[model samples]
Target: MNVLVTVTEGATVDDEFRIDGLAIDDGSLTTDLNEWDEYALETAVRLAEADLVDEVVTVTIGPEDCEGTIRQVLAKGADRAIRVWDDALERSEMLDVGAKTALLAAVVETEEPDLVLTGVQSADEGFMATGVSLAAAVDYGWAAVVNALEVDPDERIARVRRELEGGVEERTEVDLPAVLTIQTGINEPRYASLRGIRMAQRKELAVRSLADLGLEASAVESRLRLRELAEPESESEARVLEGSSEEAAAELATVLREQGVGR
Candidate 1:
């Protein structure tokens, strides 16, 4: 069995964003791999190490700078890496659900992996749709928010436990050649070791284009448009109740009851 995972580029901003425009950072912060995607990749790597999967591959759809992130995936244990990017895509940093799905579907088609995996959501957009969208586009059964997975290679079946609201979990079995979006807390991600990093440097990171994937730039479409951006409204006044611990607890409980909470 072969598994493919998708990685996304996530950033952190130390200062305020450009509220008047798209609320984007001014490149003054730091960049890192998406936290959720790291968990997804770690799950894939564990499967590979356990001999449940014959190989693991990772794909990243971003600018060339994202190659570093892809290499990190390889160092984590993915047997191969694919970097999917184009001039048009690089120009439009934020892709709509349809566009991102199409790109991942193309990779799935090309790689023909027996299983597909991705982070439950991107750290930047937090759309929580890319994995399911790719599954739909590629016509595969999918499980979202998966916390655990088991695969039977001979039967080509995957049993997954999905996390739900209220701490409930649903277990389902899907055939092989399916997609799964992994949730955080599923596994702790490991950093790339020095030896693994050296091995990653020797592995090839294939760069793919939209054209190569039989896709057109115009075919990628966004349903939403950014009209304007602004900072969240700030509350100018909030009363602080000062008292001893016991008094504060009593007062807070009274306030909650008066506010129709926990009544």
Candidate 2:
């Protein structure tokens, strides 16, 4: 099986604030693989190790600086990594979710992997809508927030487990050539072994640009608009009360009632 893992170079809330000039400190921001995407990468690597998959290919779209995150995935066990280089994209000019999805769709079409996986959402934007959009663009079935995956390549089916409200799990089976957005806690990501790191250094990384994918700036859509960025209001300090068991219970009930709990 050939598995494709799509990753994004994202900024944290703090990083975004700093880039937008809302923060005073000019400290350089730290970047790492998105947490949810780490789960995706781990899933792909596990599948490959179990003989369920033959190769694992990781892809991402960002400036050259994104190679750090891509290299981290390669170090973890990805067979190869592809970086889509576009510096203008980092300036928030072509930052629309739909545009990004379209670019990814084009790349996936060229690669033609059996399974495509990604994080449920980027930590910074949290649009939480890219997976479905990319699937639609590529004309593939998509399952989101999948906590578990059981692939039966012989049967060409994948049984997926998703988390629902109220601590419930939803199960569904999707056919091959499907896209899945992995949820957190699906599995623990393993660190890169020395041998794996050395092997990754010899792997090939293919870079593509917007024009190479037959995309133009005018072809993208911006369904959402960003007006202004602001900091969240600081939370008030907590207050604690000490008393007898009964008094404490009563005080807790009073507080809950005042806060409109169970109203």
Candidate 3:
């Protein structure tokens, strides 16, 4: 069985950043393979390493600038990469969950992998809804926040442990043709070997537009609009009580009383 992993080029903000109108200024951000998606890709690569799957492929919705990040995953273990981008995607204020789901569903239809893996959420937006939403759109069985996975291609089953609220874990089995949003800490991602890095340069990396994916320009038009983006205003200030432990404790108590925290 082939596995398809959804990946993204997530932005990391500098310690100090500037808000450029409705978003962080590009100059103040650095892009790399998304942390969560790295774990998902690691899971797929491990499955391939264990001979549980035929191929491990990755798909991303990003611009040409993200090819370096895509190659990082390829070097680590994905067999090839598919990147989807178009003028519409570049022009949009933001690709909402629905728009992203539509784009991914089109690729899913074309690829038709038995299993699909995605990070629990993208670091930048943290919508935490794309994987499940894509499953719904594609009519695939899915589980979210999965921390453990065991796949049986012969039986067409995938058993997973989901991380739930209150430190709860739910173990369940999903049928074949399922989507699983993998959680971090499920596995230790391996670094790319020197040989692997060299080999990645020659691997197939296909770029497709919405039209190529059998989608129209409207597929990327977001229903949601981004109106404001800014740093949150600080609500309170912290003061250091400099003294011995006992004196510091006393000062802390006095400050709490002044703020009516212990009333």
Best by lDDT: 3
Off by over 4 Å in 1: 235-263
Highest TM-score: give the candidate number. 3
The C-alpha TM-scores of every prediction are 0.87, 0.84, 0.91
The sequence of per-residue lDDT tens digits that candidate 2 reaches over residues 159-200 is 999888899999999888889999989999998888877877
lDDT of each: 0.86, 0.82, 0.94
Clash pairs, model 1 backbone: none
Worst ten-residue run, lDDT, model 2? 17-26
Model 1 steric clash total: 0
Candidate 3 collision pairs:
none
Q: Give candidate 1's root-mean-square deviation (CA, Å).
A: 4.2
- In TM-score terms, candidate 2 sits at 0.84
Over the stretch 59-140, how does candidate 1's per-residue lDDT look in tens digits?
8988788788888888888898988888887666458998888888999998998899999997767889999889989999
lDDT, ranked from best to worst: 3, 1, 2
Candidate 3: which stretches are off by over 4 Å? 240-263
Residue 28 lDDT, candidate 2, scale 0-100: 45
